[model samples]
Target: MEDNIKDSKQLISEIQSQYTRLSKGQKLIAQYILNNYDKVAFMTACKLGETVGVSESTVVRFANTLGYSGYPKLQSALQELIKNKLTTVQRVEMSDDFSDENVILNKVLRSDMDNIRDTLDGIDNEAFQDAVSKILKAKKIHILGVRTSFVVAQYLGFYLGIILDNVHVVRMDMGDAFEQIVRVGEDDVVIAFSFPRYSKKAYQLVKYAKEKGASIISITDSLFAPIASVADNTLLVNNSMASFVDSLVPAMSVANALAVSVGMKEKDDIKDYFDDLERMWEKYGVYE
Candidate 1:
């Protein structure tokens, strides 16, 4: 089947072109969507109808009228539209509306759990095994992420470096970040973390790495995320929000899974490495 129409411009054009043909109820829904698409993206079909003074089926029909399979498909398209387009202020505003009016802590905690659940549920096992395989086989593995994502990259890279050899992290602070991966080639693997409001430079680095024949593994919020489009393996992680900041719990979980999986794949090598590290730690009295 053809994919859902995801481009906001195209979605808007479809709605506008079909406006006159829409029944009164759908027109009402259309008008609301046109006026508040970003906000509407977070809403369920039932809630959207409640806001537009229509029935849930009416909202579903409006989505079908726009050539979407159903309301969820249409809403997903809407989300794709604003994922990177919204600024921090716009995100805060939209998140405020989606979250509960009371019990702030519960809402935030629940949202993080939901994100982790959804991320786990939607994972592609094939892609995951392939990611582990690539990491294990790569002559060198380069990790790249920037801004908020840098922390995740560091966490993964630090642990992976402990269990694996020839691991590199690209960080702007470390003079000439790109130079770290300049030698990447067909035998290399580039695992990048990118979320909403993605880092443009990270995309450039990964693109360059891909062009150099390195395999790309992208852990991001959506498959259409910039790096994912060029990635050899795409791990879709959920980073939903109930507050101003986007949740990173799910993303971190994915990174942890990858590190552990890779370590398991190279069990003997990692065990030896850890045993040596333990000796060094004991000798240096690194622990209390």
Candidate 2:
């Protein structure tokens, strides 16, 4: 499954290279995808066939020709590619079945459920464990994400700050994100969240940290993501789109898991730390 997902990075080139060998109907399907991928990514096989004036079987054959198991696999590859490329307007216009509010709600929720399931199935356990181990031993830990991903990074940083004293969430608002992590060194661990429409600045930060000898752990959508290449351990999580906005539920789950795992490893100290925190919060009436 991982290999198939990774092949999506080269899917477009593969289609173009095999264009001449495609049948008349397959050629039509191929042309439609090549030209209108953003729209086609969200389309059903039957709908795609109707748009291309080909039988649904032709669409399946086209996918098979391209080495995918079937139409859904082909569509998944297209979705993966367009996640970063599609504009907000394009994303809104891609869905043809949002006529009913109830249907939209159900569809979006189901998509998020699927994203969580797929993420759990595909996430590398060894990499996840390695990330936890690195964080526990680090002299300092840097957390980074920008744009949409910043929410996940912030969630991670907040909880991790509670667990460990040396955690920093790189703040873009403070100044340059680079300056925030300027002190990262060999004993530090940098955990970054980078999803589709990936932040170039995040990549640059991770690369710079790696050069400075920090261990990098990248939590991203694909193995082919820019940060993945530079990461000491890459944790792949599915953040599939059901709307214009990228869903971060799966990423948040991973962040929660990381924080919990780290806390568990230092259970004795964390218990004492939180007890003091609880007393302080109660004295100040921090919560009702």
After superposing candidate 2 on the true structure, give the runs of residues whose Cα lies further than 4 Å from its correct spot. Answer: 1-3
The residue-by-residue lDDT of candidate 2 on 17-135, one tens digit each, is: 99999998988888888898877888999999999898888888888888888888888888888788877887778665876787998998898899999999999999999999999
Q: Can you list the residue pairs that collide in candidate 1?
A: none
| Cand. 1 TM to true fold | 0.86
- Residue 240 alpha-carbon offset, candidate 2, angstroms: 1.4
| RMSD in Å for all candidates | 2.7, 1.9
Any idea what lDDT model 2 has? 0.90
Query: What C-alpha lDDT does candidate 1 achieve relative to the native structure?
Result: 0.86
Span of ten consecutive residues with least summed lDDT in model 1: 1-10
Candidate 2, after superposition: displacement of residue 129 in Å? 0.3
> Residue 280 deviation, candidate 2, in Å?
2.5
Best by TM-score: 2
- Report how far residue 22 has shifted in candidate 1, in Å: 2.6
- Give the per-residue Cα lDDT of candidate 1 at 166: 84
Residue 134 lDDT in candidate 2: 97
